[model samples]
Target: MTKKSRRTHSPAFKAKVALAAVKGDKTLAELAQLFDVHPNQITLWKNQLLEGAAGVFG
Candidate 1:
């Protein structure tokens, strides 16, 4: 069997996923399936967005 290559996402895509996560309109599993990404990845991006949000205005 062949190994699958890792995928890379753009900042915009990350932001979109993160925003969806922050909205709390859906569960992580639902978001993951909808966005075709892992739930943990969505959590990571959400944390990153929250951590950096303050910097945008500072």
Candidate 2:
């Protein structure tokens, strides 16, 4: 069997995912399924977004 290559997500794409997570309209699992990514990945992006949020005004 051939091994599938891992895909690298772009910054813009990550930001989009992070934004969606922050919106809180959908569950992490739903976002993960919609984006074809793992739920942990979305959670990580959300954490990054929250961490960076404080920098906007500082």
Candidate with maximal lDDT: 1
lDDT of 1 by residue, 1-58 (tens): 9999999999999999999999999999999999999999999999999999999999
What is the lDDT of every predicted structure here?
0.99, 0.96
Model 2 gets an lDDT of 0.96
List candidate 2 segments past 4 Å from native.
none
Prediction 1 global C-alpha lDDT: 0.99
Q: Clash pairs of candidate 2?
A: none
Q: How would you encode candidate 2's per-residue C-alpha lDDT over 8-52 as one tens digit per residue?
A: 999999999999999999999999999999999999999999999
RMSD of each: 0.5, 0.8
lDDT of 2 at 15: 97
How does residue 23 of candidate 1 score in lDDT?
100
Candidate 2 lDDT at 42 equals 96
